[model samples]
Target: MSAAVRYDEVEAGQEIPAVDYNVRRLNLVMYAGASGDFNQIHWNERFAKMVGLPDVIAHGMFTMAQAGRFVTDWAGDPGAVVDFGVRFSSMVVVPDDDQGATVTVSGVVEEKLEDKKVVIGLTARSGDARVLSKARAVVQLT
Candidate 1:
C-alpha cells in the first residue's frame, strides 16, 4: 500500500498515468484455474472461432479487474475505491502467441463529489477497439 491521495490535490479533467497490462495464454489459464471460469472461449482458439469469436478472448471480468487495478494503483489504496463499473463494448481477442495482447488502461478525473470523493472516467483499449465503455470509479481520497 502507498499513501492516500488527498482530495484537494486532484482536479477534474486531470489525467492519470496510463498503464499497459499484458495478457498471455498462460495468464488466462491461471486466471481460469483461480476464478473457476474454465470457458473454452478464453483458452481454446478453435472453440472461440466456432462460437464466432476472432480467437481466444480474454475473460471480461479479468479485463475489468485490470481496469480496477489501474485506478486502485493510482489511488494508492484498494480501499479508496468506493464504486466501480464498466460495460463490455468488445471482446479482447488474445492471439496464441508469446506477446498475446495488451490492454491499455487510462483515466481522468471526471468530477469531484462531496465528502472527498472523485469520479474517475476510465478507458480500456486493445488494439483499435475499445474493450470497456462507460467505465467509471468513485474513489475516496484523504
Candidate 2:
C-alpha cells in the first residue's frame, strides 16, 4: 500500500493521475446481481432499445460507485470520504463486444477545506459523452 497523503501536501489545482475502468456486459451482470438492480437497460440491449435507449446502457449508480472507488482509492481509506455525489449527465452505452466500454476518471484538488480535508472535483467520460457532472468528493487526510 502507498503511504497516506498528508493534508498539507496537496494544493488546489493539483491533478490526480487518471485511471481507466472497464465496464463490460459481464461486469454489468455481476453488478446487477450484487446490487439487486436488475434494470433491463443495464443488460438487455433489445429492452433498452425498446425503452428508447441507443443500446444497453450502464447503471447510473454503477458509474457513481466507480467514481467513488476512484476517490476512496486515492484517499487510501473509503471511510475518509465525508461527502460525494454526482449527477448522471449522460448514459454510458455498453456494446456487446470484446472491447466493451471504458470509463476514464480523473480528478483535481479543487479546494482545501477546514479540518484537514480537501474537496476534489471529479470528471468521468465514456466515448464522447461526459457521464458524470457536478461530481465532487470531500476526503479527510492526515
Candidate 3:
C-alpha cells in the first residue's frame, strides 16, 4: 500500500524498478478456484498440450491482475488508479515444477495529466514472451 511516489515528484521517462513474481501450477490452481475460471488450459497440462499450448498456461485474467498489481503497488494507494487496461500479447506457460515460472514487471512514467493524474506504461514478461502489451494506467496522486 506504500507506493512511495507522487504525481508532483514524478517525471515522464522515469523507470520503475522491475519486480519478479513466481507462478506455479499450484498458484494457477488457486487462481482458478478463486476466479471460477476452471479452463483446462489453465490447469490440465495434457488438455493444454492437446490444444497446442506448450503447457498449462496461466489465465489471461490472472496475468492481467499481476500487471494491475504492479501498477497499483507503484501508485501507493490502490484508489489512486483512475483507469487501467491491457491487451494480451502472449501466453504465460506454467510448467509443473518447483522452479515454476517467473513473471517480471516493469514500467515507466509516460505522461502527466491535469487533476494530479499521471499516466504509466507497464510491461509484463514471462520467460521470453511478453505477457501483456499496451498496458497503461492513469492514477490520481495527492
Report lDDT per candidate.
0.95, 0.94, 0.90
Which digits, one per residue and each the tens of the lDDT, describe model 1 over residues 1-142? Answer: 6677899999999999889999998989999999999999999989999999899999999999999999988999998999999999998889988899999999999999999999999999999999999999999999
Per-model TM-score, in order, reads 0.96, 0.96, 0.96
lDDT by residue (8-125, candidate 3, tens digit) is 7989898989999899999999999999999899999899999899899999999989888888788788788889999999989889989889889999999999989988899999
Superposed by TM-score, candidate 2 places the C-alpha of residue 41 at a distance from the truth, in angstroms, of 0.9
Poorly placed runs, candidate 2 (over 4 Å):
none
| Candidate 1 least-lDDT 10 residues | 1-10
Model 3: lowest-lDDT 10 consecutive positions:
1-10
Model 3 global lDDT (CA atoms, 0 to 1): 0.90
Q: Count the backbone clashes (under 3 Å) in each candidate.
A: 0, 0, 1
lDDT of 3 at 67: 83
